[model samples]
Target chain A: DTAVSQTPKYLVTQMGNDKSIKCEQNLGHDTMYWYKQDSKKFLKIMFSYNNKELIINETVPNRFSPKSPDKAHLNLHINSLELGDSAVYFCASSQAGGGSTQYFGPGTRLTVL
Target chain B: SQQGEEDPQALSIQEGENATMNCSYKTSINNLQWYRQNSGRGLVHLILIRSNEREKHSGRLRVTLDTSKKSSSLLITASRAADTASYFCATVPTSGGYQKVTFGTGTKLQVIP
Candidate 1:
């Protein structure tokens, strides 16, 4: 079984549109994260949540927001998508230990035209 | 910005060969972990080494960490074509509690059969 999963694996939309990507993990992890992979293949962390509490919110733009309804699910919503928002969005999760390894999702490829 | 640095941004090796990728970070870490990602996909956790430990081995993957130097190395033995992927070293900074697991740029490995 897949440990971590993300929906809308492929997303194509026009500029000024709004989109949301959902992520879930069945690994019994208490923390979840959202990372963005640019065209250059650079993976950058955008947000992290622990047990439904927002812990890390990187310098992501206000147009992008992450919401965690529960410890096992975290979703990202992008408002007024722009051309610069075209990239792969990955969701990951890990145990709540001080030091733990994260398991990633299949990734959502967002392309704004 | 990335919290760690990976050397030899890209590597190519033949089957049955050994490949080594190095990572260096700037801050104190609670633990270091390795991840692998296929092209256009999410990352998969490989291994983890605590700050108090120097080395750890799992199957053909051997990881070494030197807290004094703030560097680590991931060695893959008997690599196969399936091992051709981007390897990343993630550092869990000592300042945070499991939410700051930052990833490096990653080293792309192309293993030939």
Candidate 2:
């Protein structure tokens, strides 16, 4: 069984359009996180939610928003997608503690043209 | 600024050869983890070493953490072609609240069959 899963493995949208990527984890974890990997393979954490509560919010642009409906799901919504938003977004889940292991979903590649 | 920085951005080795990757961080961390990401795939957790722990081993993977130097190293013994993937080091800071993990730029490893 897949522990963590993401929707729309690939997304190609024009600039100024809006898009959303959905993520779900079945590992019964309490903490979920969103990460953006740039072309250089630099992975950066964007947001994190613990037990459906916002916990970590990095220096991401205001256009990007993360919503966690429950402990098992965290979705990312981007408004006014720009070319710079083109990157692979990953969702991960953990047991909600420091030094806990994280299970990652197959990333969603977003291409803003 | 990135909290963790991996050395040797890229490495190529023959199958059966051992591969080593190093990571350096700037802050006090609760633990450091090593993850592998195959091309077009999400990151996979490999190993984790806590600040108080000096070394750990799992299968063919060995991890060592030196908090005094603020550095860590990952060693893969008898690497196979299947091990050709990008390896990253992630750090969980010692700060309070939800400890957000910061990932370093990965080391892309290529194993020649």
Candidate 3:
């Protein structure tokens, strides 16, 4: 079974449009995260939620918001998507503890035109 | 900003050869973990080494940690073409309450058959 999964694997949208990506994990993990991989292949963490509680919020713009409906799901919504938002977004999950291993989902490739 | 940076942005090797990747971080970490990501896919957990542990081995994968130097290394012995992927080092900061895991720049490995 796929421990972690993401929907809308490929997204192409116009500038200023809004989009959302969904992620889910069946590992019964308590923490979920959203990461952005730029064209240079630099992966950066944007947000992390533990048991539906916001835990870490990086220096991301307010246009991006993450919502966790439950411990197993975390979704990212991007408002006013710009050309800079053209990158891969990855979702991951892990158990709530130090040194817990994280499982990532197939990334969503976003393209802004 | 990225807390970790990996050396040798890319490596190409023939199958049956050993592949080594090094990572250096700028902070005190509770643990360091290695992950592999195949092209167009999610990241896979490879191994993890705690701050107190010096080295760990799992099958053909060997991980070494040096907290004093804030560095780590991942070695894959007898690497196969199937092992070709992007390797990343993630560090769990020691101060964060929820332990935000930060990823390195990553090393892309291409194993030729």
Candidate 4:
């Protein structure tokens, strides 16, 4: 079974438009994370949620927001998307606490024209 | 910010060869983990080594950790074409509570059959 899964494998939108990406994990993990991979292939963590509670919020712009309705799901919403937002967004899950192994989902390629 | 930086951004090798990737971090870590990502896919957990541990091996993968130097290395023996992928090192910092997980700049490996 696919332990972690993401919806909308590809998203192409115009500048200033808004978009959302969904993530789900069947691994019964308590923590979920959102990461952005730039064109240079640098992966950076943007947000992390533990049992639906916001735990980690990086120095990302306010235009990007992450919401976790339940422990099994986490979603990212970006407002006023700009050309700089054109990158791949990855979703991952892990057990609550430090040093836990993470399971990642197929990334969503976002293109902001 | 990215905590770990991997050396040798890319590596090319023939089948039956060994591949080595190094990662260096700037902070004290509770553990270091290795992940592999195939093109257009998500990251997959490979192995993990704790701060107290010096080395670990799982099948053809061997991982070494040096807490004094804040560095780690991953060695893959007998690489195959299927092993071509990007390898990343993630560190769980000793601080930051639950937000300590950080990924490194990945090293892309090309294993030719």
TM-scores for the candidates:
0.95, 0.98, 0.97, 0.97
- After best superposition, candidate 4 residue B106: deviation in angstroms? 0.9
Better of 1 and 2 by DockQ: 2
Model 4, B52: alpha-carbon shift in Å?
Answer: 0.4
- Candidate 1 Cα RMSD after full superposition onto the native fold (Å): 1.4
- For candidate 4, write residues A5-47 as lDDT tens digits: 9999999999999999999999999999999999888889899
lDDT of each model, Cα atoms only? 0.91, 0.93, 0.92, 0.93
The digit string of per-residue lDDT tens for model 1 on B15-75 reads 9999999999999988899999988778888999999999999999999999999999999
The alpha-carbon deviation from the true structure for residue A106 of candidate 2, after best TM-score superposition, in angstroms, is 0.3
- Model 3's number of clashes is 0
Encode model 1's per-residue lDDT on A9-108: one tens digit a residue: 9999999999999999998899898999998788888988889988888899999999998888999999999999999999988887436777889999
Candidate 2 ranges with C-alpha deviation above 4 Å = none
Over B1-113, each residue of candidate 4 has an lDDT whose tens digit, in order, gives 67999988999999999999999999898899999999999999999899999999999999999999989999999999999999999999888656467889999999999
TM-score of 2: 0.98
- Model 3 complex DockQ against the native: 0.78
- The CAPRI-style docking tier of model 2 reads medium
Candidate with the larger lDDT of 1 and 2? 2
The better candidate by TM-score, 2 or 3, is: 2
